[model samples]
Target: MTNELIQAQFGPRAMDYVRSSVYARGESLGALLARLQRDPIRLALDIATGGGHTALVLSPLAKRVVASDITGPMLRVARDWLAENGAENGLFCQHDAGLMPFPEGTFDVVTCRLAPHHFADVGAFLHSCVRVVRRGGCVAVIDNVTPPEPLAVRFINAFERLRDRSHNFEHSLPDWEAFFSTAGLRIEHRQQFRTPIDFGAYCDRMSVPERTRTRLRVMLLQAPAAARAALNPREVDGRMTFDLGELLIVGRRAAR
Candidate 1:
């Protein structure tokens, strides 16, 4: 699906993902919520904010939350979600990850969870994150990544593209570090996070076709032993059960 087509895909399933424990309580949002609960925070910008999971968790802790996405329907659904959830501190706006419509140094904290890989330009996205955050403010990012091994990276990325056309590329650790450093954001914390996915639910989330899903399953099943070892495809009841990996990267904007 192109970005425009998938834009429609997200809002319709917004509630589905919001209610899904796999997504809401999964790796990225879970870590973000944990950090907020442990400390007082204010004035956050949740980039992408698909399903509003990150915004919902962080809104209550902040004085104000500006959750932005390129998709209008998505922002609408997120606005509705915040209203119903008693999170009056939050607000929504249309924004592209590669380019945002906000003034500089406006927010104390910024977050992009499980959504960066969809950006057609990752460097521009990170720099935009840096631009919005105030000096000494924190920026948190979360996304799936492949291991450094060449074969493993190619296989994982290719499978993801087959399953979800909107997927761009999952950056490696060095790529992230270099981007953040040059963007003037210091890496504050890094965690290799994992979230399990039953094969069917994962495919369905992206609305993958039956034929493509079958192809993905066969690819995983027949993967070279080394590749399979890295991906570790598993099954229960003779059906594909699990295969997913994620990462959480927390950074601090340079002190002015």
Candidate 2:
């Protein structure tokens, strides 16, 4: 998964994105902690620890954590956030999840959340995850996924790309499962997190050009009736409101 775009796009706006963004809201730390059957320890890694939420949430559960990202500025922000959260055990590093510098079988628990869609090579990303996690260790990945239907997937991905140039693709549930399996990980748990992004706020964060923003609004508003119905497009007082969705999925690195 190439991160050139993410590095360029988020490197400068790291702090702003962390302070006010969609990923920071919804899905409490307790929810993620509760999903873990056993405490994570021995070794752990949090890839693309944007805002350091995942590191702060999972730090205490693990003996050690290596939080990494492609952008140095973003990693600095994560470092500060983790320090503020009193998670001194967490360490931040600049690394590409697609081409990590860590050794194989180094981590017992690995996680990447809401960041995969920025990866240009999803399969390569998964393979890297599989490499670092020990056999029978866990790799939990959370990302926005498109609906299985081709049309729905197309529309969702297209809109997201228009909204954020860093956007790559959101794989459906089945595809993600197959992806992990092919990389020697087995699905152990999964959940969907539907986060409604206030339309204007969402548009503002990207600093999307005015014309592009207008295009996005018109495209979403003019979505096919069926798509709109299925999405239950949120509207506030007869106006388009928000649109967002995500999946919190966990997979175990099966012993070969």
Q: Which candidate achieves the best TM-score against the true structure?
A: 2
Clashing pairs in 2: none
lDDT of 2 by residue, 15-112 (tens): 87678656565673345677654854777899888877787778888878899988999889988888877888987788877888989999988888
Against the reference, the lDDT scores of all candidates come to 0.79, 0.79
Model 1 TM-score is: 0.92
Candidate 1, residues 75-109, lDDT tens digits: the string is 87778878888899988888678777889988888
Ten-residue region with minimum lDDT total, candidate 1: 31-40
What are the RMSD figures for all models against the true structure? Answer: 2.0, 2.0
Model 2, position 121: C-alpha lDDT score: 84
Candidate 1 CA-lDDT value:
0.79
